[model samples]
Target: MKRKIAPFILIALSLIIAVGLSACSESGRNVEEIRIGVTGPLTGATANSGVASKQGMELAVDEWNEKGGIEVEGNKLPIKMYFEDNQGKPDQGVSTAEKLFNNEEVDFLIGDAFASSVTMAIMDLAGQYEKPILSGEPVSSAISDKITENPDKYKYFWKGNVGSDAYGDSVYQTVKMLEESGDFQPTDKTVSFVVEDTDYGRSNADEVARLLENDGWKVVAYETVEVGHTEFYPQLTKLGSLKPDLLVSVFTADSSGVALVKQINETKLKTLHTAVYYPTRPEFIENAKDSSEGLVWIPLMFEPLLRESQVDFATAIKEKWNVVATPNHALGYDTMNNALTSIAEAQSLDSEKIVEQLAKLDRDGILGRFVFDDSNHTIKAGPEYIPVPAVQIQDGKNAIIWPENISTSKYQK
Candidate 1:
């Protein structure tokens, strides 16, 4: 009887030790690591914008980590970023998103520069997975239209920048201001427009043209160019023949803008040249050089008009990356920081809860005060927040020329 009791006691002791070790291993698991997935055209013609955006996100994450990361529900979780190169293609964008959602299991997502096609392609996946996606710079109205049409289906998607209509109106307002100020006077009040075939370029061009016509400006020439068309002399020469007062080229690709500006100078097109978005990039100034001079553009974020906190953030970017932060960078940084803010406010890692907090967020930061319109989930463009400044390239540098309060220089013909 003693021997049987001894064997049973030994078995019971072994079981207790095994259970204790299992509990220790379970408690040791890492639950303080939050994953964020980012996608962009990291290795294509639009790489400059993509790289800038990625750098901005990295900087924001670094800053958060330096402060011991974000605290949620009593846990200070460190952020880990994972990036996927979408190459600015719709198919690739979808695939990259799948990898981030399934393989990496990221808690949040961001990115895709300038291309609305990529942004639209990923909306379904974002909705299905219930992940909140903050778009970096895809400013097409189609994004908002879809959201407005079916809010329940695409509730997780949010835009980081103002819509193309806002940009178009700002451009029109700048020209009107110039005319009123007597800085620019065209005898015929005639205009010509050129746009890339992409959704971004065409949509902005259409809006600008519509606004110009409503303002009594005649649109004599309207043309569209393929995305990578290198030579614009044929188009510019034809438009020059029309002898319009203003020649506008709405471009999304950097190389196309550079090439078009070079051709515009070579052809000696006397009409004033204006572009959107692309001209704010450093590559535009570097590649176009003197040709880029006198060109007018609408920058989503103008550095000179930024708040002190934004200025400080820009300085930090310059110091760390050895590059001047463009509007694209600001968009990237602002979107990430906004997401972080939402996470902190929610105090939970659930994506839906974060979305709820985002809808209610109305705070100022790098990109100005961000208040999302509940109907479409986009920030309204205004001087108070997300001012679309009409900037002109004077002496190969960006100078704010509109909204007198922030104008660094008067508009010059």
Candidate 2:
């Protein structure tokens, strides 16, 4: 009986030891793969911008993988991207977010680059799952406001580009500069807005109208169009009838922007056509053809007038993709690079830890020096950080025309 009891005790001890060793191994295991999920309008009206952003993110990921990937806890972890097309719809965006978080089990997430409505729809999921989102190009100020209102609830959301208010202010500044330079003068001192009927477009148009009204410019006509609306002749005709000094368009769809610009040009409207965020794409020029000429656009960053460091990145993207990099592309590259840096700083793959490091990250890249505002979780927009670059289409080329220091050409009518 004593011998039997002794054998049983020894077996029990061995089992305990094995369990301890297994736990230790699991705790110290190195991350093998870092999964990143991306959502965008890859197959809808805004597919051009979404595709460009994906290319930029892919370029950054490829570069890191070529360099043996990101190092974590003395082990190199390769990046794996899982891309989902939101198709520029709010419901689809939420579903895509759920798939990335639940099915794919991605460690990080990026994008929803084309539509602000889609970005806003996914914020609830980001908060619920505690996954950090480095948004690519969604510019609605509502996102920042939500984060600011509830820091803990929406701390995971960070804007990768300027907010709508900043964009509006930038457009205002350009108009003021033009006014001062005697390039633009209206007998009526009036302006009109033709905006997409979405959170992004409406918010930006409201901000621009507010600023213009404050500056003593009368807003003559304000019209809203659906997201994928192609026929803009009615809106353009109404705006033309107003005979305002300037026509500000806030369209996310490249097709809409081209059609509107072409119609405005063909109708010979005297109002100066300026857009917020749409005309920065190379496809805009290709689609609009000569109609895009003389159109001014407020871009988050202008690729042609990028800083030296940014120029290198632009060159790399152009060579690899055989297409010019737009502001969306720059935002994508910067967002991914920033995420990689934050992961390294956190020294762990845990989502919460990555969020902690991201809150404190302040670095410079293609989009210039970036530091998220503590309250809003958005990159501060000013001269010192990510200032808006106003680009104008001149002779079938997009050229910087504002912030004189970076201007490649004067404002062309």
Candidate 3:
């Protein structure tokens, strides 16, 4: 009996020692790898937005990691990111969100920048999982609007950038500026709106049309094209017959805008060339060339006069990734920075606690002064994402061509 008892005691002691060693080993693993989940389109038409956002997140992650990562509960852990491709589709976004929540178990989520509809679709799941999600680049006011409209439905979702109202506001200012300049008369009062039929396009176009109509401007034509509509002759011809004063083209891809530019030029539409989205960048030079000269549009960011911090960061990212960062990158890096700041201040890894810290976030970045407003979002601000420079396509490239207050007017001289 004594022998059996002794053997049992030794076995129990060994088991206890083994358990303790396992606990220590688990703790020894890098605590800094606070897994952040990233979702966006890496391929497809809107790949630019997703890829740009991913690069931005990587850039921020690299910077933070080099700086010793975040401190949480007396432990320092490096931030490790997990990514999934949503292919710029709403259904895909939902699945991506689910995978992040269930499988990856990311500490936080960011991305799906271009898919406004997709962002809205996954808002509920984010709430269910109690995981804080920083919106990557979706610009529809609807993201925070829907969340705040029904907080019970979505309490974990927040945005790090402004929305499409920037487009409408800039348009209003540009039109107003043009009117004041006396270069264009108020008689050119008819405005036409065109967009891809996606959620982002439709929502943005609706807001633009609404704002213009409220400003007492006549909407000469309001048209929606299917996502991949290649032929714009029908829409352009129909709009031409109406004789709008300015054509507001709101397509997604460079090819789409290029197609419209070529078609309109060939047809000799007499309307002023005004648009949002692509055809306002250097790429506009490749597609529309001289025809794009004097084309007016609202863009997310102007690369030339970027802040020193932004320029340095952009240069580093380009050197590392061999790709230029866009506004999407700014949003991603800001989101990561905000997350790290929250984790450091809170000193905990809990997601709900992070939400409280995020709401109080007030930090400036490459994008601009970021203060998530009552809408629980931040970005360039006034009428158009306030303070965002309204750029015009000039000499085959985007040149500051108006409201010198927001724009640097580098091309003014």
Candidate 1: tens digits of C-alpha lDDT, residues 1-413: 99989988999999899998778544433457878888888877677788888888889899889999888779988888898998888899889988988777777787454477788888778788888887778888888888999989888888767888898888888888888888788889898888888778877888888999988889898888877667888898898789899877887777899998888889888886778877877678899998888888886474633345667777878998989877677777877788888888888778889899989988786777888888898877888777888888888777888777877888767
Q: All candidates' lDDT scores?
A: 0.81, 0.82, 0.72
Cα RMSD for candidates in order:
7.1, 6.1, 6.0
With candidate 1 superimposed using the best TM-score fit, by how many Å does residue 253's alpha carbon deviate from the native? 2.5
TM-score of 2: 0.88
Q: Write the per-residue lDDT of candidate 2 for residues 1-413, one digit (tens) a residue.
A: 99889989999999999998778644633447888899998987788888888898888899889989887767888988888999989999989988987777777888566678888888877778777887878889988888888888887777777788998988888999999999998788899998899989988988888998998989888899888677877877887778999889998887788888888888888887789877776677888998888888887475645456677777888899988877777877888888888887887787788888888889887887888887788888887888787878888877788888878889876
lDDT at position 28, candidate 1 = 36
**Which is superior by lDDT, 1 or 3?**
1
Q: Model 3 reaches what TM-score against the true structure?
A: 0.86
**What C-alpha lDDT, on a 0 to 100 scale, does residue 139 get in candidate 2?**
84
- Candidate 2 overall Cα lDDT vs. reference? 0.82
Error of 3 at 176 (Å): 1.5
Query: Candidate 1 clashing pairs?
Result: none
Query: What lDDT is reached at residue 343 by model 3?
Result: 70
lDDT (tens digit, per residue) of candidate 3 on 1-413: 99979989999999999998878644444454788887788888777667777887888888888998888887778888898998888899989888986677677887555577778787777677777887766777777678667776566777766777766676777777776777666565888877887767876777777787887889878888866566888887898788887778877666778778888888888876677767533465576886676677776453634345568777777798887656666666777787677777777778778877877777776666666665544454653333555666655556656567545444321
For model 1 the local lDDT of residue 283 reads: 73
